[model samples]
Target: MIRRLLPLLLPAFLIAAAPASMADVQLKDARAEAQAKALMETLRCLVCQGQSIADSDADMARDMRSLVRQRIAAGETPEQVRGWLVERYGDYVSYDPPFSGATAALWFTPLLLLVGGIAVARLSFRRRRG
Candidate 1:
């Protein structure tokens, strides 16, 4: 039993000993800070449910925050930075996914369902009355 557990624990120890490649991000200018904050609010933390990267403390979120600062410091526009993250992590990382053909169903499904339910209710009431 000890031998079997050793293999599993070995990997955990190695991972624990690995260095975390994180940066201490401090946006030098107000413009960069503002842009980073706005963009962070729109980015969802992949490791967290219903939490924006800006509000998350997960390692992934910290790395993502650093990446956002780096991109902004490199003079990328807010839209470009968002696009870069989307390209890396896909649409799931975006809180406000773009209104494109693929996302139309997501955008309109709730409204469509509401209308369909109202229509069904009205038809049911009419049938019962007649």
Candidate 2:
């Protein structure tokens, strides 16, 4: 019984352990490929949250990588591709979102929070000392 199951189990194990398929197909031009890769690194992987599309293995990231490569191969500039993605997915998709009225809060919130935190800490320390 064990011998009979061994073959089936072996294939299953191999399949399960196999790495995920490559996300982006290489562009014909090396320069285009490099541009796609750089742009991918700037785009966040929605599924993986912290990883860039270039580094993520999630399905969404894979699709994003393919899209970037396809657009770049079609003669779109990296900025154009990035703009399209930002329009489609919103500013959250890019690691470095452009500053604008819509994104002002995103760019300033951290600085505001740090200042607020420092003020509160200073007050607390003063109160404790007095």
Candidate 3:
């Protein structure tokens, strides 16, 4: 009976020990890790729908994570690295782009559409009422 119990407990023991064994494998430097995490969050996963690189587990997200860590380790500012990625991957890779000339439309287009829709609905309602 004790031998059988040891076999079951051994698996549990190893499972519990796993985290302590791999703690250093994740992130050793808090600040750098935070910077890498922030950069990754700003990037979208090319292969996943509506998933940011930071939250995705896809291969593309893993590659993006590696690139982000490399850029952070090389002393690139988060914004600079993001700019470089945007240049290489276009605005689709960015979860949020800086508001500027061409991107201005992105910021205002939805609001414009909402207002237009409301106006059209009001006009239709008035016509029905008249």
Candidate 4:
């Protein structure tokens, strides 16, 4: 009855609930694997903002790694794969997003902030002396 099937059904339920394995998709060629790894390092993990996809343990990072490997194995250059990802996810997905009109503020905001801080500090010091 139900008791006899419980053990078998338990294993099936566990398997269905388990996350997909990340190792199943990989490039057979060593060079392609290397390319995929390099590309992974350049991609930022959206879920783990501070980590590259290569260094992240997030499920999104794992999927990104799988996509890189599959694309490389299917003969796409690393740049092409990167372009596809950037197009789909926007420049934020890349650690080194291209310099362009849309991203100009992203690239220059740090410099601008630094200069503004220095100017403010200088003005504050002058006021204290006067």
Candidate 5:
């Protein structure tokens, strides 16, 4: 009975002891860590949908985290690093992508929808009152 339970308990213990993900690693310096953390927050994890690279544990997120630190360590400014990533992966990698011809709709669609919705609501209310 004891040996049978030992095997089951060992697996559970190992699983519990294991780190959540390899992305648990961080930069040694406080400033670099903070800077990388901030920059990573601006980036989305392509593999994890809604999660930032800083928060996601997916393999791509891990690589992004590493790259952020590497660029920062190499004396690249935060904006420069962000631009490099965007140039490499396109605006989609950044949570708040820039406005461009290709992404013009993304920039204006929400305001357009809000205006349309208000117009419809106003028409409905006026018709009801009349």
Candidate 6:
């Protein structure tokens, strides 16, 4: 019985040991972790909504998080990492795209909508009162 259990337990133990083997790859410094988390939050998950890649538990998110730490530790600045992600995943993967010609509407549209909505409401109120 012990022998039978050993085979089953051994693989599980090995699998658990694998992450430890790569433990050096993990970012333990609080400041580094905070930078990682902040960068992740600005990234969009290709698979989920309003959910940033950092907040997601999906495999893609994990991969992205690992990639972020790797890049940061290798001396890439935060902006460079963001640019790399844009090159790899395209602008859709970023919650915040730079204000430029193609994405100009994205940055301005929400504020425009809000202003237009308030104006319409005020006009309607005046009409109703009159």
Per-residue lDDT over 1-130 for candidate 5, one digit per residue giving the tens place of the 0 to 100 score:
9998998899898765443343456768889879889999999999997999888978788877878887787889889999999999889899899888978887899999999999999999999999
Off by over 4 Å in 4: 1-20, 23-26
Candidate 6 Cα misplacement greater than 4 A, ranges:
1-25, 28-31
TM-score of each: 0.69, 0.76, 0.68, 0.79, 0.74, 0.68
Cα lDDT listed for each candidate: 0.85, 0.87, 0.79, 0.87, 0.85, 0.79
Give the winner by lDDT: 1 or 3: 1
As for model 5, its CA RMSD to the true structure in angstroms is 7.7
**Candidate 6 residue pairs that clash:** none
Q: What CA RMSD would you report for each candidate?
A: 6.4, 7.2, 9.4, 4.5, 7.7, 5.9
The model with the greater TM-score, 2 or 4, is 4
- Candidate 1 per-residue lDDT, tens place, 31-130, comes to 8888998999899999995899889988888788888888898899999999999999988799888888878887899899999999999999999999
- On TM-score, who's better, 1 or 5? 5
- Model 5, 83: alpha-carbon shift in Å? 1.4
Candidate 2 per-residue C-alpha lDDT over 35-118 given as tens digits, one digit per residue, 9 for 90 to 100: 999999899998888999999988888878878887888899999999999999999999898899999998999999999999
Q: What TM-score does prediction 1 earn?
A: 0.69
Better of 1 and 6 by lDDT: 1
Clashing pairs in 2: none
Tens-digit lDDT string for candidate 4 (40-78):
989999999999988898888887887788788889999
What candidate 1 gets wrong by more than 4 Å, as runs, is: 1-24, 120-130
Indicate the worst ten consecutive residues by lDDT in candidate 2: 16-25
**lDDT computed for candidate 2:** 0.87
Q: Count the backbone clashes (under 3 Å) in each candidate.
A: 0, 0, 0, 0, 0, 0
